[model samples]
Target: MSGARGAWWARIPEPVLDAVVVVVAVVDVLINLDDTSGPAWAMATLACAALIVRRRFPLPVFLLTLPASLMLDIVFAPFAALFTLSERSRDRRLLVTCALLFAVASATPWPLDDLSSHERAWTLVYFFYTLATAAAPVLLGQLVQARRDLARRLVEIEEAREHERLLHSQAVLARERAQLAREMHDVVSHQVSLIAVQAGALQVAAKDPDFREGARTIRSLSVDTLDELRHMVTLLRASGGRSTELTPQPTLADLHKLVTTSGIDAELTGELPPDVSSTAQRTIYRTVQEALTNVRKHAPGATATAHLWHDGDAFGVTVTNTPPARPSLPLPGSRQGLIGLKERAELLDGTFASGPTGDGGYEVRLRIPNRAG
Candidate 1:
């Protein structure tokens, strides 16, 4: 019922509530004027006016109402001011000071009365009653303030979560845009490169001056198109503001040199056929490079073992690295290399597998069928 009353009061607009305070104070003064003298009546009237601005200046208004309450039979003016001051006060000094003053005023007898020394027990009971009355309203005010603060905090948290969700959505859209640009580049670049090669063949085979000149023009146009396509791809990649290494593509023959120069302790077992196609060689080369790179990145200063063999109709390659012993500058990667490698192997109707070993190391395996030219 207290909660329901508080909620109902909370819905009351501030200006209307302030007006209600003035009306109530005026009524109190009118009803209790007969019990007080002329000076007390005048003070109570002024306090009733002060109640109009009690919320804006609670402490000052409470001071006005305190005197009026002491000298007159008006109860609501002082109690209302007490509740407002306690509810709105941010300073500890104000709350404590106002509380003590109200307790003292409530405990004291305003009208002179003859009482004997035997009424000491009655004094104690009156003191306890006054103290409890002073405390109860202040506690209620504190509870109301706490509820308001909690509501504000909940609203702020919800707004923050909504902002985070918006940012995540933007990030997802950007990644999809980059992926689409990449697909366009790969497909377009490969076809243009083939056209350039065919044009070069035409230039070499033509005999007539006119035909040779036409072939030369076609070759030049195709080469220029391929270059433009490469530039577009570079721009797309750089749009994300991520750093990229500007190095030449690695191949199978560069494996030995890579392992040696990178200062990585690795053992290569079995051998690759010397007469393999460039496509096959490039796939094998990049797979080895990516595997070794992961080893150096995740487990620096650890020993890695690689095994490559031609098994009947398919070629199998496996690379495994142990955990690092001595920690070094850890490298960062998105593990996108493994994802690309899986796609690469699948395109060639091959198999790719990678995971942790039994000894807490990492392993990657690839099996390529020999059926492709």
Candidate 2:
């Protein structure tokens, strides 16, 4: 539609359009008049002036030149309909317009004085040559625009693909965070419940010094465990407990109380890595603690061993115990302690496996990578 409007203005026949196209062409030749003169100069002016209507009524302007040029003969200009076919449009319009332009060009200079009678007999030959030459520049411009449009579309497709990838990544992160929160809730609640049960038992059995000492140990473990649980909650709320009230995090050194409170014979075989920060140590401690709790509940008579080793890149831990002599006792309720331990190991870029070991024993192994907290 815009192309049609521009073409209509070009062929408006207003004094301004006529004067600009005609005067410009004449001035162009006058500036280089020494190089060419006569028929060529007048024809150049007519071609320039006729082009004002080339985009709007291309076929009509080309036809108009035929009668007007026949009257003036040597002074007529060649018609160029090249501009009409340059824009993106239907093929039918281009074919009709080009045919009309060729007809006008063929009839205008009939019976050329410079050619032999045999050559002049076929005027259509010269008409086709002129049509091809005039259309060359417009065809080149259209090809360039087509290539540019294809490049723009390719860039748009790449950007849309990148946006979808980012959306998928955000959704996965949200799901993992929710799963981690659920695991933490189960682990902390299980530990607190066990501490409460032990405290109640000690209250009735305190006549013995061993029972009195066990009661004190339970008090200490409960306090320390609550502090770690609070720290975990703070981490869930934000990045860490920076702005919240939090007790100091536990390390491998704190595993002593954890084993003591459980009232089990736990033989420690290897040393823990001293170089790693508090977080990794705490994670290892919690994993061992959870594995021991499982042993106590499911295999009460089994003797347990806690092993910790450092092999340069990671801290390796193993908690293993023998089978129970009697039927396994059921705790108050089943809890997700092992699931939380796995989550804690993964958060630190670690690997974990827990199940029955060969030789009728159960074992849990964790390998936590040594990275800066």
Winning model by lDDT = 1
What TM-score, to 2 decimals, does candidate 2 have? 0.35
* Strongest candidate by TM-score: 1
Give the per-residue lDDT of model 1 (tens digit) for 210-258.
9989988988998998888788777666543222222134456666776
Least accurate 10 contiguous residues by lDDT in model 1? 240-249
Question: What CA RMSD would you report for each candidate?
Answer: 20.0, 27.2
On residues 1-373, what C-alpha lDDT tens digit does candidate 2 reach at each position? 2343356554576667556655654554455445444565555566556767665765555554444344333222332333344443336466546545545555456333586676666656655655565555356535544544444434444544575477466555545654565577678757786886788678567898888888878877787777787677556644222221121366778777777766566777788656777778878878887888677666656789988887777776899999874344233545588888889888888998988978888999999876733
Give the per-residue Cα lDDT of candidate 1 at 241.
22
Kindly report which residue pairs in candidate 1 clash with one another. Answer: none
Q: Supply the global lDDT for candidate 2.
A: 0.62
Off by over 4 Å in 1: 1-13, 112-115, 118-120, 177-191, 203-235, 243-373
